[model samples]
Target: MGRTRDRLKKAIAQSRIPSSHGIRYANELLALGAWFREHAEGVPAFARNRDLYAHVNEEVLGDAPIDLFEFGVREGSTISKWMEVNSNPASRFFGFDSFEGLPESWRGGVGETPAGSFATGGAVPRLDDERVHFVAGLFQETLSAFLTQDYRPTGNRRVLHCDADLYSSTLFVLATMHPWLDPGSVIVFDEFDSPLHEFRAFVDYTSSYRRRFRAIARTGPLLARLAVEILE
Candidate 1:
């Protein structure tokens, strides 16, 4: 397991953050998840193992070939969820992370950085979904050409999620994906009320364009995540 995870982490760190890489990765994980569940399948303590991911994916994916991504896939929960519902022989999920751990400068919530939170710090949980894929290291990049590479089969374009806790990382993704997004594309912000820089930067950047954003979904909490549509 250690060797497998290390290999996955390495691939995520080195490859481009492709739109389809994630889904493919999740599908590959299914065998491992099933194997673990086999031995511990009936245990009550494993209740959390109801496979939340499968439930979410089934509801969201249907029979379509959707391309999914998680800006902050800490321990791969959301990625797992995407895998459960969408992991067909044909789906793609991409997860980005700073695998070594959170950045020392990730201050964006109410006050200080989320304490004892963020990445699980433990091994990634098992799940048998080949659609999920992880990309380690920071997206501290300026150029956005990575968005166009290794794309999946879909009309939705790219779905770029900004969950980098810090203000700068969030803004960077918005600016980068801006040119690539089409009408149906969506951007999910993990913390819109970040006291740091995210809220201000996104507000300021969108304001410059005649096309502002329209809120589509919000999970709640003052600084909760946000999903909005970028006007054309």
Candidate 2:
């Protein structure tokens, strides 16, 4: 009976939802979400966070290859989970980290954690996945190198996931990636809901722009800091 129930649960998770995502990548997202939840047990309690990243990515679907840059990837877990679920042959996932740990200081005041406290000692678990790319060193330095030398996009269909933990690095990415952005570009703030970091960065980005945007939420509390926003 327990086995039967498990099979039924798996069946439900594997089921694809109806979406305007077209055929290929649309169905892939549903499956990837299921796989991430199933096989990757004993993982950190970051599924919900990654799900938020994936959900917003789904809303900004395109037939062209998917290009993504993740500010912080502790180990390649989230991207691996994402690849398992979506399994996009064309999609490319990039993660940027100090690898050695957090930066020196976060400039403005942040939350409970100190500026350098979150450092992981630069030892992110390595994985050999074709879809994933790992960028080591400070984002401020590595990012510009990538745009000119390493990264070449098709339609430049990109998703920027900023988990840099501080405003300086976060704002730096926004400035550099701004020119590459098209109407389809999607930016994910891992801590966008935070009172100090992301919100402050968003204010700076919006301060100069005259155009307004529509917001979409897939889960959690609708308040700004409590949830992630989809600006369209």
Candidate 3:
């Protein structure tokens, strides 16, 4: 059996088929679909992301104030939607972004988004809400520092919104925030259906950290936006 497996591996290593983006993406989707069947088969689904957010705020999270951390603040639209959904005065929203767009190119099933795709000229959003705050800089540069010096732990439930549409960014946020992710914490992934990016990062993070989560809700086609609650 071992010799047969080695022979198969050797043959695959020497195969001449050149892989393209479409081919790779198709394989990723197949893998992602299998995973979804196992873990996310019956979760509630929503048509739009905002509706999903509202459901999370009202149904899943209830009226209690939460510490909402948004990892990708492109134009501040989603974070703003979160603020609108959770109106408790005690809830705090922290948005982290370069405000300069994606740190690297994002190759999706559709096409490639060039680096700096969502750049806002390094300007943060102009939201008037006092409870909302923005942290500017790369996640690699800013998240750890913020977690160390500025992060204040509270009894409030924590909601982590991961919209960073790259594997590196998502993985960094997940691994860094692992220490603070108590069981019952809620995590929402904005581009969850991107098999090579968010989905891959999520699988890697959970497996590496030995963490468990249960899907609570999903939105958009092919479960594009997904929410999960940490089980332990």
Candidate 4:
């Protein structure tokens, strides 16, 4: 009788909705949201942020010296991964973070993560190689100068990895980073399941610019991968 009861419970649990289904359903809604926003305005489009980076490196970057940008480098593990997969001598990697944590609490009811969470007390991992650089500060304070003055500004494909959790921070990075994106660039969002933050920012940014992108790949159920390439 106990065996039967255990089997029954297992059957019921299997019959229940799987979390991946929820991810799919949420992503579908996100797709619709992007569509509506695109029609209304424009739209544009991470992982450990490495799997997607590897996908892009293999599929799009082959032999090309690309520029990689990672937002939210907590322990700098992702930065190290990028360097590992990319061997092009001229390639450069830029990691941006407050090194303190989220600038604020993530948007409403999203999760328990609070403002200033993930703070590293301004200490970040040091990568000795010159090919890699770190920009330490709030996004608003640092991104503009990097976009305009510090970066080489030309001759490389752009790859962006966004790990920041808040809606405002994600939105700011998207809006600020848009002008630099070109066709063939790849953007990977590490926590895209937060509908109100990363997801919403993406829909608005793409719609606002009337830009077009296509979902090219996905990593697990959390990361969203997108590509902006000219259709020919």
Candidate 5:
């Protein structure tokens, strides 16, 4: 009887029929492909760093002092890139990270990312410039305090660079930054297509707050830039 059952299970495994999860994943991919097809021209145009930099430069007011924040500053590469492209001398850059990778697993247990996957051993990189600053520790521990006390109003033109890859982390950061996000603020997501993480978080946040944000530019399906129109 045991041998017969094992053979039956093996046959099922070898069959062409896919599991429920497989079907769902296929459907989701199809939907994503359809979306890409609909937004074809813009996807390729803004996929490169130079193009994104050009768009940001045009979007921001040249005379205003820039207030830029990066959520996941891994080895300080992107921050450096931003500083390099920015011609405004008064622009201030803030990079936030635990330097110890993700605080928890993303998308429950199904997702492959493990906790502490991007850990940097708490070693913050030196940007050398006095205009740039690094905030160490998890977002939950440092974000609120930074907003309340340390973050002085420089200019209305602000840019938030989100690299943290998890629904919880993204949601928390959005909610915490809500009050400060006014008109002309740009939020860039580095991993926007992680459906269970960034995509879901953005949808839930916008719906809950009734905020009106437009996707001004995108660097392929992975990276997207949204311009805020919030009043308060």
Candidate 6:
């Protein structure tokens, strides 16, 4: 089996045919499907991402005060849902985004989402909630400073909402935030079905970081929105 896998990899690397690109994507989806079957087969499924968030907030985190960091806040919708579901005054919600959409073109099952697709004309949403905060810039430029100077670790559970639709963005956030990821940290991915992007990041991050997590809940077709609890 190992030899066969190696031969296939070699052939794929050597291939220059245009159709090979599609084959590679299909292979990634196959891998993702296998992973979902293993990790999320019996997990609760919801009709909407908000419902999944509520489940994670109420059932998984027990509606306790949480340090929620959202990586890709476009229009502030999902973060708003999170704040509404977990209405602990003590909970702090921080949103990080370029507010300029994706840094690069994203090619996934739904075709290419061009760079700047989600741009809000560089304006941050106006949320009336003081508990919510927004950091406007690319994650590469802003996150390290925020983590070092502004972020304060507390007794509150940490929830990472990774809506960044690019593999590079998702992996960077996961790796950079590794130090603060405790055993019980909850990571909710907003687009887990994009095998080459978010799902690839999840697989790579866990493998590279030596992290362990269990899928607790999912929503959307093909488990698009997935929430997992870190176990180690």
Count of clashing residue pairs in every prediction? 24, 3, 0, 10, 0, 0
C-alpha TM-scores of all predictions: 0.60, 0.67, 0.89, 0.75, 0.78, 0.91
For 1-232, candidate 6 gives per-residue lDDT tens digits of 3432443465456555465565776688778778987999789999988889998998989999999999999999999999999999999999999999999998764357899899998999999999999999999999999999998888899999999999999999999999999999999998897778899999999999899899999996457899999999
RMSD of each: 16.8, 15.0, 6.7, 8.6, 8.2, 5.2
Model 6, position 173: C-alpha lDDT score: 96
Give, for candidate 1, the lowest lDDT window spanning 10 residues: 43-52
Q: Model 2, residue 200: what's the lDDT?
A: 56
Ranking by TM-score: 6, 3, 5, 4, 2, 1
Candidate 6 global TM-score:
0.91
Candidate 6, superposed: residue stretches over 4 Å from native: 1-17
lDDT of each: 0.52, 0.57, 0.87, 0.69, 0.70, 0.88
The better candidate by lDDT, 5 or 6, is 6
The TM-score between candidate 3 and the true structure equals 0.89
lDDT of 5 by residue, 1-232 (tens): 2332343455345545445533443444344345444533243246576567557666644545678889999799888888877757889999999999888875321236778888888899987889899999889999999999999986547888888988898999988998888877777777765555675677678779888765556665333443333333
Cα lDDT tens digits for candidate 4, 1-232: 2332343344345544455644444454456445444432232223434666676678767848878888999988877888888988889889999998887766332125678888889997888778888999999999998888887766888888888877788789888987787767777676664555677777787778777776555554323443334211
Candidates 3 and 6: which is better by TM-score?
6
Off by over 4 Å in 1: 1-63, 85-89, 108-110, 114-127, 141-145, 152-154, 221-223
Q: Sort all candidates by lDDT, best to worst.
A: 6, 3, 5, 4, 2, 1
Question: Which regions in candidate 3 have their CA more than 4 angstroms from the true location?
Answer: 1-23
2 or 5, greater by TM-score: 5
lDDT of 3 by residue, 107-149 (tens): 8665678998989999899999999989999999999999999
Error at 158, model 6, angstroms? 0.6
Candidate number of the best TM-score: 6
- Please say which candidate is ahead in TM-score: 5 or 6: 6
